[model samples]
Target: MFKTRIILTAVILLALVGVLLANMVQRMAHLHQSDAEYLRLFKEVVAITKQSYVEQVDDKKLMTGAINGMLAALDPHSSYMPATSYDEMKVHMAGAFGGLGIQLGTKDGNLMVEAPIEDTPAFRAGILAGDHIWSIDGKPTKGVPINDCVSRMRGTPGTSVTLGILREGSKEPLSFKLVRAIIKTKSVKAKLLEPGYAYLGISEFQERTGEDFERALKTLAADNGGPLKGLVLDLRYNPGGLLDQAIRVTNSFVGEGLNDGLIVSTKGRSAGSEREMTANIGDKQPHYPIVVLINGASASASEIVAGALQDHKRAVIMGTQSFGKGSVQSVITLRNGDGLKLTTARYYTPSGRSIQAKGITPDITVEFAKKPAQPEKKKMPEIREQDLDGHMQQVGAPKDAPAASEPSAAPMDPKEQELLGKDNQLARALDLLKGVNLLKAGLK
Candidate 1:
């Protein structure tokens, strides 16, 4: 009888605690009319699923799916990262990661490639800018989350991943079976295009990009035998990376005198979100004519660099409009090692121009096009006796004219093939730089 009384007392206490939790949930739900209705609906669905579902589903999986759905509805950039996904993100931010090396985003409910990192599997596979990813490994990508696509594409190095791509001009989707590899990005690449003209390609801005860019400039100067007369800063296919690196890149061009001038600014709801970034006075690059190359693939930090340099009159912008991704994502880690990449702020150019949907417009627009192969010249109608004006007796059977010699095609180095690859954009940038230099000399 005593044992039975003890069990009854424990049951009574448990019933009281359950009653208290139910009251708290009711009060929270009543905070707003819509909240109350939604909470009711949420409970109904969960109760129904638990009682009548085909198979038993774990509560944790159900809660995780709910959270993912909620965040997905917010924006394309905001999402909940599972523990594994969060770990991969940490690796990416650390500047080295394994994957196909293509930066992609969701566009029109489909996956689209923003840009492919240089020297990576994607780049080596001839994946050009503006290619739409229709599917991955035979799975359709329509309405798929960007994070899901990223997670699926990235895996162990040397593993094969097939992508169904719909190129801009192609009539049908093309399939590419690519082997993923560890992508080690060389953020800054520089070489002299000519005696005094330099070409610098910034693939992406990272923690080390600022210093790497400085080193590249010095190397270019040494190659040119002096300070570079002009530079073609190629941010064409660069998908922006770090915020600090963007400011540093802009500073490299703008130099020391106006270190206090605004480079870029951020505004958010939080107290500390509003801030202006500026350049620092250190190892400033020489004042030289700069032509910045951009394209639809350039975005975020890349836009910051372009906008800052343009506003300061430091570089002449060229190429098509950028991929307008002006928002900033702050990664917040949760207690369970998961993370939330939330869009906490929007980026503005130095002139207060919002870069959200309206990307940086180039001062000069240069559309990319492949140069058509030259057609072979037809041999002039053989000089016939009837057509000859003054028909003189042919001294002897004219020896067959030697077959026209064709120009020998030489193999181009990777750098040359990249910069001048059938596109007129880079060529135009170089011409603009030369024009600037000529005008400066004329003024002198």
Candidate 2:
């Protein structure tokens, strides 16, 4: 009876295996058939274009265009970079390059300025974020690929490039002639706001950004004479760079106990593309109130840092909504020195939030506003007691007794005043941090 039962189970298992094999074979056949059909169509189109084109096209150019078109169809971030463009990209990632330091992106088929790196030509030229790039050097940039536009803008350090920009509220397109320079970006800048309050600005994430950030934090603490009481992490106009650097920056503030130190995760169709990056065992900041500032220009890695901190409840995000760019790109270098920047996966925050098209909403929504210039003080009519018609001296008071002077508050640092004056969002962040510190003290 036992042998009979075992035989029946073996027969059932064999039958299931046979059915699974058949399905696998059938799917493979279908996949091959579809691939073959599309390949044949592509070849036919290429042959026809080569034979009946207005101008004689090089074979290499035709192939390159085809590759670019395929990648462009997939997404904006994915692109095929030729050898020269690939080289330029590598240099840019190395934290220095010769160009007008404006990060570019596409919005609704229009070329848009993502952000201008601080102190660069583009930033000094007043090239604001969200400005539509209408033309480059007087040539229309309507359908130009981003790589091509970048090439046109980049040249010798001393050379000039003119960009025609269409601003949101402006009636006419504005022209900006800027001289390109060797843009060596210092990723992090730190300052002590007050006795324990601090401000740290991350302009862009680069290869050394993590190290720079750590150094900046230490500098801030030293300048403040101790650990920070509160921090305003300014990520405004910071077009994100290296992914690992972003994770490292986020890891600095997050402790091992929070979400198992998971900073971010990625999901893709392929098993190899999916990944989870967690913070290392140590390297956490002191528990303090933090306010992270982001604007429309903060994207990719910036969004990652913001999302991670937000999910952990480690920082209060304050500003306008972020520039939603959560795609993870993998750069594959070809043998011929060319490269392919492919969007392999979409990253998620620790809380399982995919901020792809939907950005990280700030806990406190603050719009960008410039502090209005102080109006020139008018000369007040001096009506002193001695100048008044019914002025009378006290019986025992000295004639020249100095008026009782009120205690004056400490004067603000000129640099801090200038920075806060121009940035309303930053000012609000400082206020919030101060309030948080006060509230914590009160509760204790």
Candidate 3:
């Protein structure tokens, strides 16, 4: 009887395994069929375009346009890059490139100057934030795609590009001639706010950003005669860069004492794309009060650092809301030296909050008090992720919720000797840091 029972159980287990294998095979076959159908449809479309188009379209151009359209339909960050553009991107990551030194974007079908890097051609030429690019050279830029505008601006060093800009109070478009050069920016700048208080400004993250930040902090400590009582990290107008540099910067502040503490996590379709970056105990700065300054231009890697510090309760975030750009784009190089900048993942803060369309709100809101003589009726507002042409919506985000908005920064006074002296936001951040230090001393 025992031997008969064992034979029946074995038969049952084998039958169950066979059923599971059959289902797996069926699923794989269905996926293969779907892929084949998609390819057939795509080929049909290409064939029709090749035969019916008015001009003799080159096969290479058709393929490139199709790839670009596919990625553009996915999200704004996803893009197809040619060989030259891919080379330029590599130069940008290495922290040097020849161009106007300005970040570009599109707003309501018009080219907009997102922010001008300090001490660059655009900045020196007096290209203010929120300026509408009316024309590039003599051609109207009314509906030009952003990538095309970028290509027009970048050229060999010592070449010049002309821009027709429309400012807020200008009665007509103004033209400025800018000469391009290899712009090499120092990512980190530091100074002593006062004895025991330091001010550090990160213009952008680059290859050596982490190393530069550590060296800046050490120099500030030596200048202050001891460890810092408080520090203000300024990320205003900082367009973000490499993800590894963002991680390195965050690790400097919050990772040392906290073991396996979450900094950020990414979710994507592939198992390999999902990742969680954590901080480990290592060489960390002292437990001093930190205040992070952000504005509408802070984005990408900048948002990562700010979100992580805010989530970990390691710093007080102050200023206007940041530029919402929480998607991660991975540059995948093709066999022909071209590349595809594809949006592979969405980043989440340590507290599991996705700041894709909704940026980091300041813990304390501080606005600079400056009124323009004539504010443009249709002012270019802060460009967030939602403003992009095909930005990805956050996963599980509310469909009916309105797009997030950022407080517009007061127009800067160009003639002012020291803008920081009149910056209300910076003043408030400094005061907060000072108050925290005072509280700690009193408690002791």
Candidate 4:
């Protein structure tokens, strides 16, 4: 009886294995058939274009354009970079490039200026964020690829390029003739606001931004004569840079307790693209109040840092909503020194919030505006009883001794006043930090 039972079980197992093998073979055949059909279609189209196009097209150019079209169909951030463009990108990541110092993006098929790097030609030429690039050096840019636009704008140092811009409030397109220079960006700028308060502006993340951020923090402390009480991290107009640098910057303020020190995580179809980056155990800032200032131009790594800190309750986010750019692109260097930047994943904050099309909203919504002008001191009418005609006099009290004049406030520092006058968002962040510090000390 036992031998008969074993024989039945073996026969059942063999039948199950046969069914699985048959399904695998059928799926493989289907995939092969589909792939061949697509390849044939692509070849036919290429041949037709080469033979009957309006103009003679180079084989390399045709292939490059095809690759670009494929990537563009996927997303805006993904693109194929030829060897020259790839080399330029490497230089750009290293924090120096010869261009107009303006970051570009696309919106509804129109080329738009993302942000002008601080102190660059584009910035100095009054290029504002959200301005549409109508033409580049007399050539229409409506349908040009972003990489081609960038290449056209960049040239040897001291060269000039004219951009026709369409600003929101302007009736006609404005022209800006800017002389390009080698743009060497200083990523971090720090200054002490008061004895215990500091301001750190990260223009953009770069190769050494993390290390530079740490050094700036130390410098702030030294300038303040002790540990900082509060900080205003200004990330306005900061189009983001390297991913690892963003993580490193976040690690400076966050310690290893909340959410298991999870700063950010990425989710993708492939296992290799999915990842979680956590804060390492190291020297971190004390439990000081922080207010991170972001604007509509803050994107990518900027969103990453803001999201992480906001999730951990480590800082108060201020300013307008951030420029939502949560997708991660992995740049793969191809043979022949060309490259491909492909969108691999979408990153999430510690709280599992995705910042893709939706941006990081600030805890405090402060719009950008100039500091209001101080009202003129109106002269009093002097309409007291003493000044009234036929009014009763103070018989005993000696003519109500003129009210002692209040001491005038000490003059504000010229630089501080200038800064507050220009940046109302930063001014608001400073006020909030000050209020928080006062509350912590039980004085408010």
Q: Write the per-residue lDDT of candidate 3 for residues 308-339, one digit (tens) a residue.
A: 88877788788888888889989999999999
How many clashing pairs per prediction, in order? 0, 0, 0, 0
lDDT of each: 0.78, 0.81, 0.81, 0.82
Candidate 1, 8-57: lDDT as tens digits:
99999999999999999987777777887899999899899989999998
Poorest 10 consecutive residues by lDDT, candidate 2: 399-408
Q: What is the lDDT of residue 293 in candidate 1?
A: 88
List where candidate 1 sits over 4 angstroms from the true fold: 1-37, 97-183, 258-260, 371-421
The local distance difference test score of model 1 is: 0.78
Estimated TM-score per prediction? 0.65, 0.69, 0.71, 0.70
Using TM-score as the yardstick, the better of models 2 and 3 is 3
Residue 108: error of model 2 in Å?
A: 25
Q: After the best TM-score superposition of candidate 3, give how far the Cα of residue 172 lies from its true spot, in angstroms.
A: 26
| Candidate 4 residue-wise lDDT at 239 | 85
Model 4's C-alpha root-mean-square deviation from the true structure amounts to 17.2
lDDT by residue (tens digit), candidate 2, 1-444: 999999999999999999999999999999999999999999999899989999997999889898988887777678899898888778767887789998899998899999998899999889999999999999998898888898899888999999999999999989999998998768788887677778899988888899889988888888877777788899988878899999989888785675478988888888788899999878677878888998777888998998888887788888877777778889999999899999888888877877775567888899886544797566445222223232222211111100000000135688888888888888888887777766666676
> Which pairs clash in model 4?
none
Better of 2 and 4 by TM-score: 4
